[model samples]
Target: MPYKPTVVLSAIEEHHSDGVFTHTTVSRARAAMVRAVQAIYPLYFETMSRPPIEVSDLMARDGEKVTVLVHRHNNLFRTPQLIAVEGRIITTAKATPLGLIIKGHRNRGIALAPTELVDAVPGWGETAISALRARCEAVRALLPRETAPLTAGAISAIPDDTADAASCTTVLLTSTQLPYEDPVHGCLWLVSDRTPGSGEDILNGVLLAPPTSSLVSEHGSIYAGQLPPYTAHLPTAAALTYAEALDLAGAINGKDPSRGYLSALARLDAQL
Candidate 1:
């Protein structure tokens, strides 16, 4: 007898108006179809193995806070004159006698100031503040559905130029991870940056997979969105190291290594 495909069996099962076929016969046919497909495509039926390293996996294992470093860019200023931190873009406003007031739809047009606004323009006061509030709303709308709510906090702003050292900014970490299209593999990596663009430099755009790995770091350089001559941000305890970053890329590519340096680091850090 000739083999029957699932597509044909499914059609027959759907058009059983004649009531000549029994449920048992139909079930057997469906089962046979599944087996045939599996036999023909065993590779596709096999389970997709997990990567050696993943951001969530590392976070779960380490329980350490990952520091996402975002480079200040002009594109961020284009939308809402906002600053990116961790996973959010935020603007600062002063607390008036009434309270901290932000005029925008996201904040319901008025909100108590979380902290004193820094980098406040001198001449452009309320107008500037209102514009920023609007911008904040616009950026908020772009947030992915899986993102957590925007949480207010403080962050360190590292200047791109060596002449200027790191400064502090009272900002919010949206705690929301933005999805970036990795040009290299055409996969999606959740990155933290307020502005959208390409490049490895922190000043060029956003950063991904912290503690060592960045969207454009040499250790694991996963982001293909930006152009070449990729320069990575410095690695810190809060970010992925070069080896760990590579492992992460490997994992994303469905390559699981027996052991990764990140696991060793975690073990060493635990001992300390």
Candidate 2:
């Protein structure tokens, strides 16, 4: 007898429907079908490995406060396949009148934040869909998906209109680093941290006098969105130095270490 490929067993079954078939023939056919199914089943943890960004908010009705942050890790997912959008609203009690807060602190301090959504845009669902489709295609091309027949394309087919009614807007927060230079000048700033005295002290350079207005200033750094939790806004560089000084001197230092040395070197060069 000649050996035959496994798939031929199926054809044999079809031809020999009226004839007797051996158990071996049936078993071999079943095995071949199993192999074919396994080839396309797409086995991997690619789908489950995505960072889940889901929120569970708890606020009392008519007598509570809530602060939402758009970029906070709790409100963001790291997966590229999903879309993210951020939306914000301020709610205040008519009786006591405490406005809502939506905060994203550059510092480690708690930002009195307002609620925002990512990935789900309200009125701009079409735009969001377009963006996600383009993004998914890009992700598919550049990064190999662990699962073939990945449900990525299926996601794009999901209706964007449904996103509008979503309680919070969906924001798209990719795991990739944002692409841009720092908008705020790399200067030290004094921001409100809900402590008037502390805020004022930092602003007045009592805590740590930062660079001169010419060298560093806050032309467009502060935002109405950042009114609560009075914080002194300092540039990353300035903050590092201020933190170091505070750790050692317990105050902000304004004196430049290189000032006198640079002046002396310039004078010597002039004489030469």
Candidate 2 accuracy as lDDT: 0.23
- Model 1, 1-272: lDDT tens digits are 42111111120233454689544212322222222221112121122232222222222222122211111112311211123111112223331321211222233222212221111211223454454344334322221212111121100132333433222111111111236732221111222222222433332222222221233312211232232211112111233233443445454333422122223223222311
Write down the TM-score of every candidate: 0.18, 0.16
In candidate 1, residue 18 scores what lDDT? 62
Candidate 2: list runs displaced more than 4 Å: 1-123, 145-272
- Computed on alpha carbons, the lDDT of every model, listed in order, comes to 0.24, 0.23
Q: Let me know the TM-score candidate 2 reaches against the reference structure.
A: 0.16
For every model in order, what is the number of clashing pairs?
10, 40
Model 2: lDDT of residue 248:
21
Best by TM-score: 1
